[model samples]
Target: MLAFIKRLLIGRPLKSAELGEQKINKTKALAILSSDALSSVAYGPEQILIVLITVGMAAFWYSIPIAIGVLFLLTALILSYRQIIYAYPHGGGAYVVSKTNLGVNPGLVAGGSLLVDYILTVAVSVSAGTDAITSAFPTLHDFNVEIAIMFVVFLTLLNLRGVTESASILAYPVYLFVLALFILIAVGIYNILTGEVPQTLHTPIGTPVAGISLFILLRAFASGSSALTGVEAISNAIPNFKQPAPVNAARTLMMMGGLLAILFSGIVTLAYFYGIVPKAEVTVVSQIAEETFGRNFMYFFIQGTTALILILAANTGYSAFPLLAVNLAKDKFIPRMFLVRGDRLGYSNGIIILGLASILLIVAFHAETEHLIPLYAVGVFVPFTLSQTGMMLKWLREKPDGWVPKFVINTTGALISFIVTMMFFLTKFSQVWSILIFLPIIVLIFHRIKKHYDAVGDQLRLTTCERSPDIKGNVMILPVAGITHVVENSLKYAKSLNPDQIIAVYVAFEREDERKFEEKWEKWQPDIRLVTLHSHYRSILGPLTKFVDTVAHKAKEGDYQVTVVIPQFIPKKGWHNILHNQSSLLIRAYLLYKRDIVITTVPYHLKK
Candidate 1:
């Protein structure tokens, strides 16, 4: 029944040879991989306004410059990653690049940062998606965390089916979101050109508690930098693309960057011109959609698509995180369980881990996007800095054709990303210091895992082949309750081991039971010797344990090993197990502490 349910949900298991057939082409790849970056436009500009509105309405104009700065950084990242695609076609992303050029410790740092960032991507995206839903219905606001978790679970199950299947399932919603945004942008620009004023134009602007400062602007920029969080996913998962994976991945990266730049810039520009204020209930993007298309069919369409894309945006992390974990596991930086593939050829362990972590974050934060936004950008920029720095070093070491240009581009990106990373630390220290502290601790954990693997490798290393050591004597002892089919099965298995001697011992609580067993054994002529020991206290384990200890001690004197074989009964029904006494369990438990006595169990299944 469980296997049928699994097959029903995830489809039939594919062969290992089918993995290549699952590789996606560029069109589906863009939707699958770029959804996170593209979906950020739903809340990225809103994050900027959220930070700036803390100052006065006068400072809202700063969003344009801040967004342009973010756009500049986005461009640099796209170009830098294109170079990465060409250079490292095997798809390690920041971890591999940093390890190769910047050294092992830096590489582990990059891996840790990316790992945290991917988890947050899921949390933040799902929370924002739930927010979109609540904005439309308003009644479902109470169940935000539950809704977000459902989306996570849904995505997890879809991904477990297979990569290509997940991409196909998610591509339509992403395309819908893109179309909706473009329509919103076009209609919004037309309304502005025709001097059609929105009802929100008359809405009162928020007053600043204090004047705007450089610190406030920097904080806003850092917040808006959340837009760039998922940009590296395409580079990280280049292997999932079809043939010529690097070229397809790079093209997808450029397309994602372009879409993000246009959507983000348009939304921020419209919000600035339309004078949309940050509201407690509604998001800045929702407000812009209402002002552009009003509370009608188009408005709900935009809202619906926005919510869907945000929720499905987590697909980006689902696609990349498992692959990243598999790579880290290959390097012995994490547990080997992550390296195992599922029946459908997905990294099932990694997918489940990512889902559980995201659910925790959503529940802890109460599914509030604002609360999670502050913790978002730190993990992203750390890997960006390390990856670009590594790329710069690679160019210097390799000195390939056009190395100088690549070196300069990478250097600029490294500097910009480093500054942004430190800015995130300095500006949002109280809220984000946990990530900064977590990175080194995770790196230390990686080192510890590597140390453990190293030690195990040393212990298991084989130098030379030799013949197996011979035992001087081997004794097999079978403990029987009575003359039954279970005892016959045990004796047969014991004979297969070819022990030097076999003794079937029976503990008799009464003289009558012993005499009956002796008479039956003599009549059966079973060829094995039967020894009966009478117990005064009627304690089955006590006398049996002492006999095994004596046998073990006698065998140890002659460099011999003792094997104790016990027979276990299998009942058809689970409840039937309670009907029988579990003497075998007690005997095995008592014998477990003895060093030289080996215990084995042979099962006899009962049809009834």
Candidate 2:
């Protein structure tokens, strides 16, 4: 809990090898930044139809208006978030925006919302991809949940392999997706213009209501606006882009946003013109192709391309979520495990956490598009609303004269978004209230964390002498590694600690190690008492726990205080942790809980 809040914001949060520090090519950065927004285009229009279904299929064409409205919102969002990319090119994303402009409270809310939203990005894209696959292979229809979960797990492993590793893997699929989308749009537009409209277009029965109410319109807009959710990551991911960050990041955003907008608008228009309706029985894109091309080359190609792109879109979340978690852990809203890096300069813990959360979401909702959309949109909108508002606050605070255009753009974007946020809550209230419940919990958690940090800061503010309580008989217990010459090396440090008595303990995991150590003990003629215990369990922590408890209990025996000297070896890499000095941690935790026993570490370094 305490570790989460203590961040040295001065350096890169995770130190990188020259390998990890490798410059991101302009193309790859654009691909990573654009993939999320691009992949979202496939399902963005589908969301409108799903919401309209609640009103009944009769009014599905009404989705066209909603789709158009959503584009405006998306464009504004792109422009507004671009301000964020410019304002904070150092990365850390929404958390950075919130912290810099609004107070930490708002920043924390942004961070929390982004975390939830990022996982939903994975859940949404994977679930949507599962839908496409289920459509293509009807035999897999019933296994959407299983496939979605497996994909999440698969992605987790890919991410665990680390950032550059996963990025390299995703690059090809993303580029293919871009090309396929452009081809589909071009082909669809050409067919339409050349008077080759599909023969089998299924005409609708009736509009849900010939004249729709403002409420219904707003609901449809809320569903469609989910398309804009993935754009914020580019701003936050600026640090991952190559150096001279502001220019590179801004260009990436423009390329991503502009291409996504064109593709998205084209796809939406194509669906509408072709009378594509997303039925649980038949996916809209598949239906459109089958109607036009009669289950030939173009039909299957569209299906394959659509599915691949959606799958690649899920990868964006996998890439971004770990970076987001690291930022949150730095801020103290979550546990500190996020601070740890994997072998490839990746946040393995964050990746696992995101994977598990996405899997649970997929399982709980059974990867149903309609079921997941509400939860998904709510998570994303909260962050967008918060970040835009934060940007507005910044603009108002630092309204530089020459930057009037940006200030104008961001504030206008903020006002419209603020209204959109309130409207979505009202329109999506029933399906989205669960999100509202999470908001207060996040805020409360942040507040408690702040209190904890302040308290720790207060405690550590004392002078050096005052820092350690100068008790007359402060006994220290240290867990020994039982390695060669470690005991001999630890005794000197233990004596220097000014403890009453130091006992060197060993656990006999290997018979040879025990015999060799025993022979060394007798030959060295060391004055320190050597205690050895044999244990059968493979794990060292549990047995060490028992030994520490017994020793700590004995430490309260009058003037003869007991101090157990434990040796520790800290490793820089995760895989290098042989047993990870687990005995030391367990023994320290046990002794610290007991009265009159202080567990201390005697460090030993293995050859480099």
> Local distance difference test, per candidate?
0.88, 0.72
TM-score: model 2 vs. ground truth: 0.77
Give per-residue CA lDDT, model 1, range 3-22, as digits (tens): 89999988998999999988
Lowest lDDT 10-mer window, candidate 2? 3-12
Q: Which residue ranges in model 1 land beyond 4 Å of their true spot? A: 198-210, 464-469, 477-484, 503-557, 573-599
lDDT of candidate 2 over 196-233, digit per residue (tens): 87634523434346545677767777777777778877
| Residue pair clashes in candidate 1 | none
Alpha carbon RMSD to native, model 1: 3.8
Candidate 2 collision pairs: 59-208, 93-236, 477-598, 478-564, 478-565, 478-566, 479-566, 479-567, 480-566, 480-567
Error of 2 at 37 (Å): 1.5
Off by over 4 Å in 2: 1-15, 19-21, 53-61, 198-211, 461-465, 471-561, 564-589, 599-608
